[model samples]
Structure formats: structure tokens, C-alpha cells
Target chain A: MNPAPRSLTMDALQFSGTVTAAFSHDFKNTLAIIKENTGLLVDLLAMAEKGRPLDPQRLATLAERIGRQVQRADRMTAELNRFAHSADLPEAQTDLGAMLEMAVVLSARPANLKRVGLEAVTAPPLWIATFPFGLQQLLYRCIALLLDRAGSGGRIVLEADDGRPPVALRVIARTAEDRIPAGETAPTPTPEMTGLAHALQIRLDWDAAAGGWRLTWRDVET
Target chain B: MSERILIVDDETDFLEVMAERMTHRGVHVATAPSAQEALRQVEAGSFDAVILDLKMPEVDGLETLKAIKARQPEAQVILLSGQATLQDGIAAMKLGALDFLEKPADMNVLMEKIRKAQARKMLVVERRAEEKVKKIVSSRGW
Candidate 1:
């Protein structure tokens, strides 16, 4: 069997793979703590089984937390598998709704969820002709920041409108201090998001006067 | 029949919370704090889907996914992370994850994704079974 030519795909694969490697490396320590805590819960459960009275509140909390991590771990396994394999498929005629769904899912940080609201305004599923996840993550980061900054009561509105060709997604960042999380004094978009916006040919405009930020992609092929 | 969902993560607290929440949501949930334990559960149980964390001690997310797919090919996998970067998100999607959800994800969104994953599971299972049947029938009947 003949293998596909490297020139067509090697670079993108390597680039994304390296980035994910770095990302996982960043979260490794946190993951370890979670594991340790999980072990603690098991011990507590064992003690309870032995007729030992554990802190009811602590036990309940531990149980709740353990479950969350399990779910989280499950999600990561599936995500990494899907991502590593998605590189092999031709760029999907991606749907905007699905993209929006992914963006919300990716922006699932405590700050983003509590501080801001994701209002998807465009219903027409735009058929995008590019790497969907890549673009989705990029856009999600941008919206995440806005949501993070907005604090617990902040708002971010996502809308899609036709420009030169295919409809372009617009992320409106509306932030307020109340939207920011405790101990977090400010809100900022990550370099990854900015870099992605550039790569996807999307334009980002921040209005300091209006306290709003906007991202738009023009002439994106239909 | 109980709709069992497997949850794998390094954090005991997070796993417990997820199991509790899902259980409350009327889904049968299982929890594993480490990739190895998760693999054990995957080997033993016929879970409708799996929720995996990106980073964990000993067995990491990618390796665990490889193991799960190898053993339980029918299990639907979803990736979750607290420190998700643009790269990891894309990588997860590329790797065959039904979806990649960031940490502290919205409950509504998680439930919605779960539904989508479960909804697709039957179709995927039947298709695989059909393929095997076709191969068997074609060789004998044709």
C-alpha cells in the first residue's frame, strides 16, 4: 500500500500535535492532584464501609468531585482520540451550529460560564470550508476571555452574517467587572486566540470607548 | 435498561461530582480516577460512552483512548480539560473525539452533547454490525 505524500499534510499535523503536547504538559500537574484526591475518596469510602463515620459533608463533596473528574477524564480521552484522527479526514463541510456548540463547550472555564452568556444569534448553519475544530477553538478562546472578563454577570453575543461570500461569525465581547471571577482582576484574550483569528483571516476590532470587542471574517468563500 | 456512562479523570472530587450530577440527570454513571482504573472499567463494562480527561498521572489521556478504542470499540469518547488550548482542542477533534468540552463546562451543553453522542451510538453500532454481517453473507451467498 502506498502512503500519502507528506508535503500535503505533514506540517499542519505536526504543528497541531506539538501544540496539544504542550497543552497536556501544562495540565499534567493539576491532573496528578486530582488523582491523589480520587484515591483519598476511595479510602474514605472504604472507611465508611467499615462502619467508620466520616465527615458527612466532606464525604459528600468528595463523592461529587470524584464524579466530576471521572466525567472530565472521559471527555478528554474522547476529545484527544477524535482530534488525533480528525487530521485524516478531508475538511468537513462544517456546520455553523455545530461550530457554535463546540465553541461553547471549549469555553467551559469557570470564569467564562459564570461571567458571560453565549447568545448564538445565527440559526442558518453556515457550511464552512476549513478546519472546524481549529477555528472553533480559536474563536472560543476569544469569547471565553470576553466572558471571563464579564465576570459572573457578563454577556457575549455570537452572531453570523453574510459578508463577501460564506457567512462570517462575529463575536461581540461585552464585559463588566461583575463578570470577572473572584481573585481575577482583569480579562484578556490569549495569544492562541489572536493567532487563530489571524490565521483564519478573521478581523478583530476592540472598541475601548464602547467597551466592546468584535471579530469578523470577510470574503470567506461560500 | 440503565444508560451507563463511564467517567475517567485523575481527580476524585471531579469524578464524584460528575457521577452525582449525571445520576441525578437520570443516567447511570460510573467513575474512575485514573487511566488504568478507567481502562479496567472499559474492559469490564459495556458503557454507552466515556468521558476522559486530557492530563492524568501514569496513563495519560491519549494512551487511555487508544486502549479504550482497542478494547471497547463501541464506547463513545468525549474529551474534557480545565486548561484547554487551541491546539489540544483541535487535536482532540482530530483524534476522533465526539466532542471536546473544557472544564467547568455548562451543564446544559454537556447534557446536549451526551444526547448527541448517545443518539449516534446506535447508528454506529448497527453500521459496524451490518458490515460484519455483509462480509459473512457475501462470502457464502454470493
Candidate 2:
């Protein structure tokens, strides 16, 4: 294989590692919350056994909290599972909206840590035959870059548009007043990201008017 | 007096449940949901030890630990995180954290660490008091 393809594979592996690590960290937090709540219940029950009165209301609340954490863990598990399978196929008929949503979900933890609000705008399904993992890596890298620029009190919106010959996806940054002023250098995508985009045949561009990055590719089918 | 400690974490649910559990074990507990709040609480009052989450939003635990140490060198801090890397653990310790514990840490193990922190803090306080007395005596030429 050429050095370019080999490097792209390494980049993909690195991206997968980062996403998996973030997901696992979140999953551990969910588990920790569940453990603490259950431990609290056990402590209360032990007290009751030793003659302290049991507060049925308190027990009910703890139970509810545990239930919610369990649901959270379940959702995280499903998402990670789906993400892992994305690499199984080199190219597949992928739902662009769903892919964007998954990217948003996986990037949520990092965005929150930076005090940035991230969300995916709802859109109708747009199908495309593409390398799922590569596309995800591209989307994630774009969002990560935007988040770095957005800083605190910033919001990022991910949108998918099926328009013209090249269906496009955008990562819009609604940041504070510190946006890059006109006449100054705009941030450029890293070499790794550029290489990944090239391998996937996606056109990645920074849209100055939109205050975000736009990724366009041809041959998107319904 | 019971051991007075502050627990700082961004997760409200974890904070609430952990505070209740610690309180039940006879520790006087206070909680902060952010690094700013934790700093405020530290400025407002003294704690035997601070249980700090390593991965808080805005100011993370290592930065907070440095700030707490600068403000009150006597304050003991224990770093806790759901995903603490080895490098983070070492950095925390080098920044004056008394100990580092991973999330879902056993209650017994946490309590033991807290107890050690309290003891170490008491020793520091006592040494400071002794130094103050010696300084006063020497200044008075007694």
C-alpha cells in the first residue's frame, strides 16, 4: 500500500481510539453513579435493620435514580456498539443524518468539558455510499476543531443538507465575540484531516460566511 | 470535632449521593458542583480535606488543586476521577494532591484515605502553631 493510504489507516485507528476512550469514560461515570446510589440504599436498609425507621419515600427516590442511570448506561452501550460496527464495512449505504447524530453524541463529552453546547439539527434521511468510519472521523475532526475555536459560552450545530449534485454537511459555530476577524488568517484543517478527506473523496471547506466548516461530496443518493 | 471535608464534582447526582453517604458515616460534608464553587467554599471556610473530581468542566481538578494549595497550603486534596490516566495521577500528586482515587472507589478505601488526610492536616496545623509560638518567644527575647 502507498504511504498515503497507510497514514490514513493510522489516522482512522487513532480517531477510533479517541472516540472509544471518551465513550468508556462516560460509561464508567454512569456505572459509578449507579454504584453510589445502590450503596446509599444499602446503608439506609442497614440502618433500618438496626431499628432506624425506613423512609419509603427516600427508598423510592433512590430506586428511581438507579433506574435512570441504568437507562443511560444502556443508551451509551447501544451507541458505542453501533460505532464499533461502522468500521466493519469499507463502504456502505450510510444514512448521513444518522451518522452526523452519532458523531454529535460521541463528541458531546468533550464539548461539555469545554463548556460548549453541541447538537445535531433534525433532517430527513439522505443516503450515500461511503466509507462510514472515514466519514465519521472527518465529521468528528471538524467538530473538534470548531469546539476549540468556539470556547466557553459557544454552541455548535451539525446539519445535513441534500442539495444539488453534492450533498453537504455543515458544522456551524455560534461563538462569542472572539470569532476570527476578517482579513486575518482562517484556521486550516490539519494535514491528517485533509488526507482523510482526500481518501474518502470528500470536499472539506471552511465557510467564512456560515462561520463554520462545510463538507460536500458528489453522488449522494436517496 | 468530626472530620470536615469538601467534595467537588460536576455531577450533581453523584455529589448528592456521595455527600449523604459520607454524612451518614459521621463526617461533616460540604459539596461543590464546579471548580469556582469549590474555590469559593475553600475561601469561605476551612476543610480537613477536599475530595476533588479530576475532570471538572472549566477548571479541572489539577488546576483546582494548585489553586487550593496556593491559597491554603495546609488544605489536603484528594483527586478522584472516572477516567484518570497515569500521567494525570502523577501530575496531581506533584501538584500537592494528597492522594488520587478512581471512581467507584470502595467506600472503605476512600474513608481510610480521608482519615489519613485529616491526620496529616492536623500535624501541619500543629507544626504551624509551634512555629508561631517559637517566633513570638524569640521576638520577645524571652
Candidate 3:
């Protein structure tokens, strides 16, 4: 297998950095919660030892809270692990739905920060042979762009359509008001995104009627 | 007087636990889940220090810090972030933040900072009162 182009490699690195940073921040928050809760438990126990009445119910609730946070952290770790392995193989047969879901998961923090709702609609399995990491990177970029346009109190939906030979992925933005004005134009893909799409043999287009961006690629033999 | 402080973060669990711990330590703690609510609380009541999260939905910590300072220049703000960079710390300091601490901050360290914040706030209030008295005396010509 040949090495990826420098520009694509640079883009992927940046994307990975962003996703990793966001995940780390989330992990820190989860850890902070657990730490504080455990500290509270210790404080309560000490008070009990000093003659303060211990409420067993409160203890049970605290334990439950910690358990929930642990579960949350576990899920985040699993998602991050999956993301790390996305780059393992340069090209592989990938499931479009799963890939889109991963991209949505990676982009969740950024979207939440902007007060935008992001969801991945369930789709039937659509397999494609392409650069797995590149596909994810493109999807993330598209979702990010849509999130920006969506602004606060907006929604972004990701869905994969496998009804036809050329499988397509759509990223739709739903805002309270029309994002583009009569004289203004919709946001377009960046040069780097366009370049990546070209390299991956994916046709990227803006669908005005659907008010979304479409990425369609033909299935290729691995 | 008990130290009055407001803890602001998007994480409800964090807010609840921190509030409980600070209250147990005898500090008057109020919690806000968003910048909007934090601003409202700040306007409705006075606090010696504001514990703000650096990263939040909508308005971020830096922007909220600016707003808090604008409303009350004497307001002492301690920024907390889960993943704070050096640049973020510097920026917070430049924006009149009392201090910056990463999340999972040592309780002892945070309590010490709160004590310092309360002391500083008192000093600021006393100095302002003194300046006002001096101006009145000077204008009255003894």
C-alpha cells in the first residue's frame, strides 16, 4: 500500500487531534464527577464515624451515581477505541451506517457546544470499499460545517441511503429559520474537503431541494 | 461571614457534588447550569467568587467571564476546565479572572483560592468605600 498524500495525512491528523481533544475533555469531566462523588462518600463516612447519622439511602444513591458515570466513561472509551482503529487499514470494506454513526459520535461534543442537535438516522447496511479513515474525516467535516450553519437551536441529521447502486450519505441541517437568504448563497465545501472527496472517488454535491449535502460513491472491488 | 460563591457548569452532577461539598465546608454555594442562568444569579445576588467552567454550550467561560466583569468589576472569577491549555489560563487571567484550575481540582487548593477570593473582594469593597469618603471630605472642604 502506498503512503497517503501529505495534505490528506495532515488533514486526518488535525481531525484526529480535534476528536481526541474533545474526548479527553469529556473523559476529564467524567473522572471529575467520580472523584467528587467518591470524595463525598468519604466525607460522609468520616462524619458517620464522628457520630453523625449515616443515611444508607444516600449512600446507595451515591453508589448508583458513580456506577452511571463509570458506564458513561466505558462507552466513551469504546467509541474512542473504535475511532483509533479507523485508521488501521488504509482501505477496507466499510458499513456506511456504522461509519456515519461513528462520525456523528466524534462530532457530538462540538455540536453540543454550539447548541445544535445531531443525530444519525438508522439505515440498512451499505458496504463500500474505500479509504475508511478518509470517509470518516469527510463525514465529520461535513457535519461540522452543517453545525456551523445550523447555529443555535438547530438540528443536523446524518443518514445513509443504499436503495440504489451508488450509495449516498446525506447531511441535512434544520434551523428555525432559513439559513441562506435570497441574495446569499449556501456554504460550500472547503478546498481540502473537495480534494479529499476527489481522491476517495466520492461525488460530493449540494442538494438545494433537500437542503442538505450529498455524498455518493460507487462500490468498488477491494 | 460565610464565603458566598456561585458554581457554574453544564454538568449537573458536577454542580450538585461541588455545591454539596462546598456547603459542607461552610461556604455559601449556588449552582448554575448555563451562562444565562449564571448571569441571572449574579444580577439577583452578590457573590464573593464565581466558579465557572471554561468550556460550556453557547457562551464559553471566557466570554462569560467578560460579561461577569462587565456587570460587576469587583467580581472575582475562578475558571475551571476539564482540558485547560496554558493559553486558556493566560487568557482567563488577562480577562480579570482570579485564577484558573483544571477540573478534578484538589478540594483543599480550591478552598484556599476561595478564601483568597473572598479576602480580595473585601479589600476591594473597603478601598472603594475609603475612596468615596475621601472624595466627600475633600468636596466639603473639611
Candidate 4:
């Protein structure tokens, strides 16, 4: 599909609200885990005070878990803040690499556990003139959903080729979506991605054949 | 008579451990799996204290605290969890919780805390009984 007339801009309120709500939910859940870990640390300290031998393994695991959760929460809040700031202008010339970095950092836990490899295959930094919030939402959802479907003991390959002509992503999953539990829904991708795609007048292609997913959009020479 | 104490949590293994440990230490222990069931048990029995886990799928520790305190103001409550969130600790304390204990709790330490809370409950009951006596005597009703 041909891109929209470069004359229009995305709305500010819609972009900010979408990112904020997603981050806040994730942060709230993280806060709950942090609270629990802190309390456990307090209990561990008390146990040690009475001359009871502490289990070094358990303590180390607790420390690692606490550190992971804290890092996760920090990254989520940071991304939310960045996404919030980008709402000032629509169709800004932005560095997609930085946004991808933020997304990768935010998904460290799941990505690490999934053993998924994300590679930036672009030769130089790909600067796209697009709505930042919309792009972030789109990429986040796509990556997160692929990760979720990858299962606990699985691997997925993600690559971004933001080359000069057309931009595309190749996602190769080691597991099938049918493997995911029926009760849990993969995190919903925001409408901003679809909206931006609509505004760009480009078809956002999603196909999961040959054991993977592909997203591609040919760059429209301005 | 054994000092009556209530234990509420969803995890069966932990519940069994706590109940068995507390029972072995000469405290009368009763167990419930959910906050709703806990309140039901509270209304049905005379107890000295309660042990609650903070995060449950249906109802959490904070809601349980309010319900338990409202049902039996004299019953001492100690929140328990492996993942006890900070908000849960503060909320439990503000709502008159006696203590918040983390999971995989040391049996001896938990017993000591429970005993102290139980002692406080005994004192409150005694003081209320004394006041009742004083009111009757002063009114010349007895």
C-alpha cells in the first residue's frame, strides 16, 4: 500500500495513554514481587541473627530474583517515560535502533529465559520518519507475542533489517503458538501500530508459515 | 486448653507444614484456603490469632485483614508470604496487623511471635473482663 499524504500527524492523547497504561500494569505486578522479596530478605536477616545457619544457595537465588525484578521494573518505567515524551510530534524522523534497544532491555527476563536471539541486521542506523509511539507499540507487541509463544524451554530468532529501501523483521520461533496455554492471552498489541500502518497506507503483513513470522514494509521514497 | 490460632493460605503444602508445626508446639491450629473461607472459620470459632498469606488469586491479604479485624477485633493477625509486597506489609500494619511473617518461616521464630501475639490477646481479654466487672459493681447490678 502507498503511504498516506505526509500532511497529517497522529494525536497526542492516544499515543501517551496507550504506552502509560501498558507500563503501569507491568510495574504494578513487579512492585508486588519486589515487596515479597524485600520481606523475605528481612526474614532471612532475622533467621541469620539467631545464629541459625543460612542456606547460601537460597540467599543467592533470592538476591538474583530481586535484582531481576528491580531491573525489569526500571526498564519498564524508563520505556514508558521515553514513549510519553515522543508524543509531542507526529511523523518525526527517529532512530528505530534506540527504540528497539529499549524494547529489548524491557523484555530481558522473558527474552533471556526464552533463549531468543535478537540481532540488528541493519548496516547503518535506520532512521524512519514515523510516529514513535505507534512504532514502539507495534514492535513491542510483535516481539512480546513471539516470545510468549516460544514457551519456557524454547528459542526464537528475531532480526531487524531497516535497510534503505524497505524495512522488515524476520521472527523464527522454535515452538508453536498452540503450545501456549489457552487461559493466558498473549499481551495485546496496541492500535497505534495498526493506526500508523493505516496512516502510512502500508499493509502490515503477518504470516506464520515455515515455522516463523515475517513483518515487512517497503520504504516509500519521499 | 490449647491457645486457638487460625492459618489461612492457598498452598496446601505450606498450610500443612504450618499447621503441623504449630500443632506440635501445643497451639490449637485451624486452617482455611481462602479469605472467604477464613472469615467463615473466624465467625464459627473462638480463636486467639490468625496467620495470612498476602497474595492469593481471588482475595489478597489486605482485604483479609479488614475482614478479620472487623469480625474479631481481639484476634491478632500475622501476614505470611514468600513474596510479601511492601504495600501489603504497610497496609497490614496500618489495619492493626500484629506482624507480617515471610514464608518458609522458621518454626521456632514463628512460634515465639505467635506466643507473644497470643499473650497480648490474653491481656486484652482480661482487661475487658475486668472492665465489665467494674461497670457492673459500680452500677450496683451485681
lDDT (Cα, 0-100) at B118 in candidate 2: 94
Backbone clash pairs for candidate 3 read none
List model 2 lDDT by residue over A112-211, tens digit each.
Answer: 9899888888687788889888888988889888876777988788898854567888888876564542443457888888888888878889998887
lDDT of 3 by residue, B1-142 (tens): 8999999999999999999989989999999999999999999999999999999999999999999999999999999999999999999999999999998899999999999999999999999999999999999998
lDDT of 2: 0.88
With candidate 1 superimposed using the best TM-score fit, by how many Å does residue A97's alpha carbon deviate from the native? 54
Model 4's number of clashes is 5
Error of 3 at A145 (Å): 1.2
Best by DockQ: 3
Q: Quick one: ranking by TM-score, best first?
A: 3, 2, 4, 1
What would the per-residue lDDT of candidate 2 be over residues B30-114, giving only the tens digit for each residue? 9999999999999999999999998888898999999999999999999999888999999999999999999988999999999
Against the native complex, each candidate's DockQ, computed on alpha carbons, is 0.02, 0.79, 0.84, 0.05
Between 3 and 4, whose TM-score is larger?
Answer: 3
Restricted to chain B, the TM-score per model reads: 0.92, 0.97, 0.98, 0.90
Output the worst ten-in-a-row residue range by lDDT, candidate 3 chain B.
Answer: B16-25
Lowest-lDDT window of 10 residues in candidate 3 chain A? A176-185
Which runs in model 2 stand beyond 4 Å of their true positions? A1-6, A176-184, A219-222
Candidate 2 residue pairs that clash? none
- Model 1 residue B101 CA deviation (Å) reads 0.6
Q: Evaluate fnat for each of the predicted models and list the values in order.
A: 0.02, 0.72, 0.78, 0.00
**Which residue segments of model 3 deviate by more than 4 Å?**
A1-6, A177-184, A218-222
